[model samples]
Target: MKKEFSGRVHFVGIGGIGMSALAQHLVHCGYAVSGSDRQVNEQTEKLQKIGVKVHYGHSEQNVKGACLVVRTSAVTPDNCEVAFAQKNNIPVLLREQLLGEIFDAFKQRIAVCGTHGKTTVTAMIHHVLERCGVSHTAFIGGEYNKSNYFFGENIVVAEACEYNRSFLNLHPTICLCLNVEYDHPDCYKNFADVQKAFSALFSQSEKVILPSELQKMCDKAVLFGKNGSVQAKNVHVGRGTTFSLYSDGVFACKCRLKVCGRHNVHNALAVFAVAKLLQLPLLQVSQALAIFCGVDRRWTLHPECKFNVVCDYAHHPTEIAEAVQTALSMCKGRVFCVFQPHTYSRTKAFWQQFVTCFDGAQEVIYLPIFAAREKPQKGVSSFRLAQLARQTGLNAKYFSTFGKTAQHLSKTVKANDTILLIGAGDVNNLTKFL
Candidate 1:
């Protein structure tokens, strides 16, 4: 916490997952907090219940009499409240900047950064640390159970995002990079640019933990993978995964995770490495991780009438592949995937990769792209992606509306079929109708 100004803070995009968590934390810290967003949702409703004044739409008056203003990456410079705050000579800070200030208050700060699985990894570490009775605070990117942020003391754990190099604003004594891959095409030019950002984040940390695949990039990093410092051996993947964790060629502990997917095993590997580095109680950490149901929208399962519906926030090509693979492993019958491309830039950038990602799905339905923080680009749409997917000989089709898609699925889907809704957007809401 910076002490220069009084604790009168205003958030620009308050309804966002990250922004709402930050608002709750500030209110818990005895600050006078208020915010404005374009729409009202469950997050905004929660903020209101917690005594944070929230405005539905952006307005110049929303920032009046605030000591400072915080904005998410999605908020543009031309936003009404942001522009008004600047005109009034008020201090305007990005959300990551304020998060860095909050992190500076703690001695042990852990930041989990990667192209995917940051939310799961952060939540896993938080759960383990909490079960071990470690005094810690966590700021997660997605809603975990009920809240996105947990309040504690002495330590802070947060999900570090790499879009626009925002993770650089964080101060992490221990940094965990799950895996570096090309993402956020709207920001980075190529894979090298993405790697450079992760390298910059690694440079700021006193200790770094990453997968074995990236060990060559950072020799000093504590690695975890097929042949890393910490390894998951004798792995079994079923309704869940069971594996023996080894640290430096010695059997450390036997672990089981309720979460599905081989990707989650890799996520658990990173968490186990962190626990070992921190010297937390191994038995308790493993137990807590075993019962971890996972964060919202990360392979969350809803058992409908006869068929099953699984929701996942897999917007990237690699994540989509892993998600489909996980669905295939869990489904007893055919796998039906309803995918919504998150942004136009990403769909355009990873077009070729996206074409082959649905290889494991029996049927693929394309919903309209969810344009988050970006305008539609020329020659970029879900229809084109659907056509490309068909070129790869996958059973793919494009539906312009969710209602029509739902109606079609209701008639075509049968018992024992698993419907996987994959995206980082509102596609998860479709599960309610299904």
Candidate 2:
């Protein structure tokens, strides 16, 4: 199907980050875009401001007179609009299929994919391109500089998600594969199933860039990490991070980032490798890297709070550990972690890992799990998680709601203490109480 289409295009679950970005892109291209969601939020409001018609709730009529209907993976076939579209013989497309078409239109396409850090790395690349005055379009997974969709010239930079093997849809000119790990248990049966998807991605791409550890996955890939083709050595992490970047065994330049963490150091290295492949100016790239603040909810700092409070989207076990460590490294006082598990399947898959991840936190406050699209699983819950954590010798407590959690923190937390609100769901809303 053609990327460019006439007539109205409707999106089911348009409030989603990826869906909103795509809708924004289509609107910019002059297509009549409409979308439906259960409720109006930031994404829908932004679309409304830009003249994209939005419906509050889904209905059969919502899909009427549309050239095509695009639905997020969460939207089942039984959805009213989706059913209507099919009954009326209208073409229906998955979100990723449409994204792939849009991506295919670009002459220079970069698709960044991994279990973690895709959003930050994608945004970093966007900043580099913007700083260099390169004409490019970017679809970031999270809001960067307060926007997820940036329209520019032909070059396209997109955050490729691995869930449901969605990243396989877009055939990119350059595929930046960050470290791969087991995730999306609902989609993949095992770790090897996850690796198989990345291998397929490497096979279809013209160029592949990865960390030194994953070099064995792709023979033609360029490597980044310690002792790789591109490296960030002598790392220093505080309010921010600085490192010496070396490319192909030669010193390239010193890089500094406003974002703190060794994970971000690896993220920057991936960006540097992409810059090198694109033949961008290293000096300018380093400067751009220094100035990039970071994406929203990825260690987002709330200065209004009496104490330092950080809001982060770290749901996976590996991510939780890294985020807690990053918080511990920067805070002079005790670190208090307020965690909400993202999905039941994930929590059940990595139960032990989750219990042990908050090793260094002064206290772990657990909220109800965010069951995004899954029903509650037996023997999998935040309460059990807290119990396991306590058994592990970590101070852990379970709060059934946001109010109680906030109340406990307000009484116990003191000056200089840091509160970390960590999750992938609505748990971030706890920030209003803090």
Candidate 3:
């Protein structure tokens, strides 16, 4: 074991997708890992199965023997375990700090960051690299093929999140930014604040990959959109999308994806750019893109349902708009959206956009806002959002609870009609009831 990780390393919010991946990685690295969460979920169960002690609730007693404590930004300083660690003189590190340390240990590091598509793009890079027989580890923000932590060596691929500017901790050999938009209103003052953080990451990276629209942000970056060095042409969206991949106007390969949406075409193009930089064959990478099953909760389709039910992790207005439009294009019948707005701050920040993002849906049903790490604000509620949509002449309703939402869907959703359970919260839990 490394001297730095000699004792039990503790995680305060280990149930989080990002935190669990790190905790599992430490366990594989032969470190004694322990953690606590407010509730038990898949992640906590996985850790317990691997012999890592997991407490169901937080308490100061949980961090007793820890050499170092790790916590997500959401885990406030006043958290009992965090406060205890600080008072005891045990060093506490933010989740990003530990992730940065692990990233630096690898020879080739690829960090994917954006307001949207970080998880999907990171998973795509991992998928192609694995198919090409590259030995590398990946820390995906969400599960891909039932796991978030892929164990390997030499190279590391990670989803670098911009929330709280946590991604700044990473200094990557290669950094890919899908698109930059104003998000995390709780953390960033405005769009410029968001761009400055991304610009800083691009500045430190040995090689930078960005969409054509973001070219002016980083002079050294290899662009990957329309008119970019890596571009996709003739995009046809059907079962998924089929497009032509080009590098600097030179035809690279004909690509077909199993994942739906034009957003995914952009994501795959980013992967192609990264693979080209690594000197991987375009043909092999193209084949991998075709067979790549998308990450969970990212357009995850359920065949067992009476009607088409797709679950997505799109909480922002931009992402929600894209997801709804993609569903509208693919569905044979009317499309319905059951959206649960994620946080109070985000809902309030993008109030006008959210009101119109569901314009194309046959009927839009919203549940109460999922207040993550914040108390409810006075003016922001799913009810008001529904009222706004109705004012614009769209069919919209707000249900106070998941049970009521599911009950309404059961009565209204018909065969061939597509239902999108959209949000980054516990909306997926409603799937079982449906």
The per-model lDDT (C-alpha) reads 0.89, 0.92, 0.91
**Between the candidate structures 2 and 3, which one is better when assessed by TM-score?**
2
TM-score of each: 0.98, 0.98, 0.98
Candidate 2 lDDT by residue in tens digits, 1-434: 25556799999999999999999999888899999999989999999999988999889988889999999999999998999999999899999999998998899999999999999999999999999999999999899988999999979999889999998998999999888999999999999999999999999999999898888999999888866778887889888799888888888898889998989999989998999999998889999999999999999998876667999999998999999999898998999999999999999999899888987999999899899989999989999999988898989999999999989999999898999999999987888888
Off by over 4 Å in 2: none
RMSD of 1: 1.2
lDDT tens readout by residue for model 3, 114-157:
99999999999999999999999999989899999999998999
Q: Using lDDT as the measure, what is the rank order of every candidate, best first?
A: 2, 3, 1
Q: Which stretches of candidate 3 lie over 4 Å from their true place?
A: 1-3
Give lDDT tens digits, candidate 1, residues 34-131. Answer: 99988899899999998999998888888999999999989998998999999999999999898888887789989999999999999999989888
Superior candidate under TM-score, 1 versus 2: 2
Candidate 1 off by > 4 Å: 304-306
Q: What is residue 345's positional error in candidate 1, in angstroms?
A: 0.6
